[model samples]
Target: MSGSGLSSLAAAMESAVQDAPGVRVQTDVLIRAATAIDHSGPGSPDWRARVAGAIEELVAAGLVECPRTKAGWDRRTLPELPHWVRRSAPPVAAPRMTAKPWHHLLHWVPTVDSERRLSSAERGLLDAVNRWLPAADQVPVVPMRERSWGLLGDDKALEKLRSGRLFVPGRLTLELLRCRSTWPPVQQRVLGAGTWLIVENWSTFESLCTAAEADGFDGRIIFGSGNQVGTRLAALADKGDTPASPVLYFGDIDVGGIRAARLAVTTAQGAGWPAIRPCRPLYELALASPHRLRVQPASADTVSWTTAWIAGELGQQVAMCLTRGEAVRQEAVGLEILGPAPFAALVADV
Candidate 1:
C-alpha cells in the first residue's frame, strides 16, 4: 500500500537473490540492505545520527550469525533469521546430472575482481567452449583466439548463414561457421555444369551437383538448407534496382518445402532481384507413380507423422511414404531429374 514499504535497495536485492545461479546469500547484500533500511526508512530521516545511540541500547547482538551454504555465491545467515524480506522465491537445488549433466542457465561470473569487457571474438570462442559444459545460472568467460570482424554477431547475419558462429582458440581467422560437416565453402564451379540449382539440404545439393556433372551439365550449385536464403537469392535476383536472374529451387514436395520455396521467391522479389519459382520435379516424380513411395519410421514429436500415417500398425512408415511422397533423400536420387550440363557458364556471368 505505502510504496510496498520497500526502498529501491531492499526490493532489488531480494530479486537478485532469487535469480542468482546455483545459490546465493551474499553477506554483503544483507549488510547493505540492513544499512539502507535503518538509514532511510520509517522514522529515520537523520537515521545515521541515531545509529550510534541505538547501537548502545540494542540487545542480543552476538547471538545472530549469517547463514552459509555450499550451493552458490557467498551468502550470510543467522542462528535465528530476521523478518528476512522473505524473497518471494525458493532455494536453488543442485542438478543430479548423469551421462547428460543438467547444468544451470546463466553461467555467471562475479565482476568484483576481474572487471573487463569481452571482445567479439572472445565472446564467440566462449560460446563455442560452453557447448562442452553444462547449463549455468551465471555467465562465464571463455578463452578464444582473435575474433573476426567477418563474423558479425547480428541475428540477421547468422540467419543468412543458417548457422551459429562461435570463437575457437588457436584459430588464425575468426571463429568457425557451423554447418553440416559435409558442406564445403562455395568455391569454383565445375566444367559440365548445367543450370544453377539451390536446395535446402546439403546432401541433396551434393547429389544433384554430382548427378548433373555426370550428365555433362556443369553449372553452379548452392545449399539453402537453413531456410533463410539471403545470399543465394541475391545471386539469383538482381540487386535493388537491377533485374533478378532466374534461379531454381529443388526441395521436398511437402508443404514445408513449398513454404520454403515461397519464402525464397518473396525475399528475392523484395530485394529487387528477379525472384524465380522453385522447381521440384521430384514431387511430380513421386506422384506420377504411387508404388515407388518408400516408408520410414515415425517419431511422434515431428510433423512427418501428421500427414504420413497410413492404416494398420505399419501406418507410421506407410503414411510417411505417402504424406511427403517418399524419402527421396538427396542421396537417393536427384541426378536423373537434374540432367546434363547446359548452363555451366552462369557462375562467371557476374
Candidate 2:
C-alpha cells in the first residue's frame, strides 16, 4: 500500500476497536478488506505485498498485538494505536445502562403463536415484578367490577406474571393493558410509558385523543384517573425525569377540579416525584368560560388525594368550576389550542 493508503487502513482499524467493545478484530473481515482494497485505489501495483509489510511493522512496533488464536494471515489483533495505547483514553465503558429503565423502547409480551425471545430488558422487568409482587404466583383476572383496574397494584398478580409462574389467558399481547366496564363495552387503559395526558369524561378523552392523533397526539393520551395518574407519575419518577409533558389533568371546574389538581400533585409527590406539576387550563379556564355559571353534580365524590386539597379559597374555586351544565372540555377548543403545532409547542414548554 502507498503511505497514504496504509495510513487510511490504520485509521479504519483503530476506529473499529474504539467504537465496538468486546469485539476483537475478526480475521475474515481484515483479510477481505485487505485484499479488496489492495492496489484498488491510490496504492501501488504491489499494494497487497506492501500492506502485508506495514501490518508486520505495526505488530513489531508493539502498536498492534496478534491474537493468540490466529495462524499465518489471521490478522485479528487490535491496533494499539494512539488512543488505544494511551492511558488517558476514557475507559471504554460497558454500554451505559441508563440508570433509568428503557422499557419504553423495549416490548416483551409473550404471544400465543410464537415466542420472540425476550430481551435482557424484558427479563429484568419480569424479575423486578416477581420480587415486588407478594402473590405473583396465583393471580386471578375476573371481569373487573370496579371502574378502575384495582387489581393492578396486586403484587401477587404482578409477581406471577413476572416470574413466569402464571401466564395471561392469552399471551400478554399489547404493551399496555386497559380495564373497562362490561356494560357499555368500555375500555380504560392501565399502564404506559412515553407520555400520557388525563381527562375526566370518556367522550372528551376520546375526542382529545383523536385530535391529538390527527394532530399527532398518538399514544400519549390517557383517561382521567387521578389515582392512576398518580401511579403513572410515580412510575415515571422512579425511572427518571418524567417525559417532557407533565401529567395533564383536564377535569370539571368544581370541587372535583381542585381535587383533581390536588390529587395529581399529591400522588406525584407521595410517590417521590415532587417535580411533577398539575397541568393547566381546566379549572383556571373554567372560572372564565361561558360554561362557568352552569350547574352540575357533586356526587362523583372526592378520592384520597383530593380530600386534603378542598380547604382554602383556591380549593373553593376548583369546586365552583365543576358546577357546569355541559362539560366545557379541552376537547372542544383543542383544535384551536392543541392542534399539532400548538400542542407540540406546549410539550416542548414542559
Candidate 3:
C-alpha cells in the first residue's frame, strides 16, 4: 500500500474507533477508506491483499490495535483482520438536540425536549402544525403528500411522521390532514369477526376476491400489492367499530415474499391488530403446484422461521424448496385449486 493509502486507512480506523470507542470498525469501512487512495480498484485481484497489508502496517506502527488475536498475523485474511481498538482517542460528546422556542407547547408536543434541541426543519414543521391546528377542523382535507408539500415544500416530507421520526401536535394528525396513502383495495364479505385474508400478488388477490364474491366467503379479502401490505395494514386500526379479526397472509414462497410477510406481521402487531399468520392451506396448495420459479436461496434463519409458521410435511416441503432456490407464487393456487368455496375450507382450519 502507498503512504497516502496507509495514512487514509489509519485515519478512518482512528475516527471510527473514537466515534464509538468499544465498537469494532466494520471491514467495509476500512476497505472504503483504502479504496479512495488505492488505484488498483476494488475489483482487482490484489485489492484485499493490499488492504490486509495496510491494516498490518497500521497495527505495527501502533496506530490501531487488533483485539481479536495476538499471533498468526500473516495467515489472517482481510475479513479475518482482528477487531481494531484505539482507547487513547478522546471521548466523543453526546449530541444535544437543538432547543426551540416551541418549548411552551411541550405538553401538546411530546417530542419537545429542553435538554435537547430540534432541527430547523422540525421547528418549521411544528410552526406549521401550530398554525394549522386551530383551523384544522375547518380546513379541507387533502392528501398527505399534498399537505406536506404545501407546508414543507417537499411532498413526501410527512411520509415518516407515522413512524415517529417527525413530530406533530396531538390535535393535528396525519388522519386529520388526510395524509394516508390510498388504502389497499379490500372486499369485506363477512362484516364482523372473521378471518382477514391478505394476498400478495394482484392475480392472487383477484382470484380470491372472485372466489369470495362467488361463494360469499366469511371474511375480508385484502389486496396486499406485494410489500406495501406493511404500511397498508395500518388502515385496519382506523376501523375502530369493527371487531378484531384474525389476519392470515399468503404470498409467493421466496425471500422477498417471506420478508414482506414478516414486515406485515410486525406492522400489524405494532398497530395493535390481531397477529398475522400464514394461510397454511393456501401455502400447501401453492407448494403442490407443478410450476416453480428459480430464486435466490433464503438465509437458513428465514427458511426456518417461515417453515415454523406452517406445520407438518408441508413446512418441510417449503424449507426444502427454499433451500434449493425455488419459489412458488401465490397465484399457483388460483380458482382451479381454490374452487368456488375457497374460504370455507381454508378459514375453518386456519
Q: Over the full model, what C-alpha lDDT does candidate 3 score relative to the true structure?
A: 0.63
Q: For candidate 2, write residues 89-157 as lDDT tens digits.
A: 342433322333324312323331134444444445444443434543354433323212243434334
- Residue 257 lDDT (model 3): 88
Can you rank all candidates by TM-score, best first? 3, 2, 1
Give candidate 3's error at residue 256 in angstroms: 3.5
Best by lDDT: 3
lDDT of each: 0.38, 0.41, 0.63
Candidate 1 lDDT tens digits, 187-210: 223443345566767766676666
Weakest 10 consecutive residues of candidate 2 by summed lDDT = 78-87
For residue 87, give model 3's deviation from the true position in Å: 17
Off by over 4 Å in 2: 1-195, 217-219, 226-246, 281-288, 293-341, 346-350
Query: Model 3 — which ten-residue stretch has the worst lDDT?
Result: 72-81
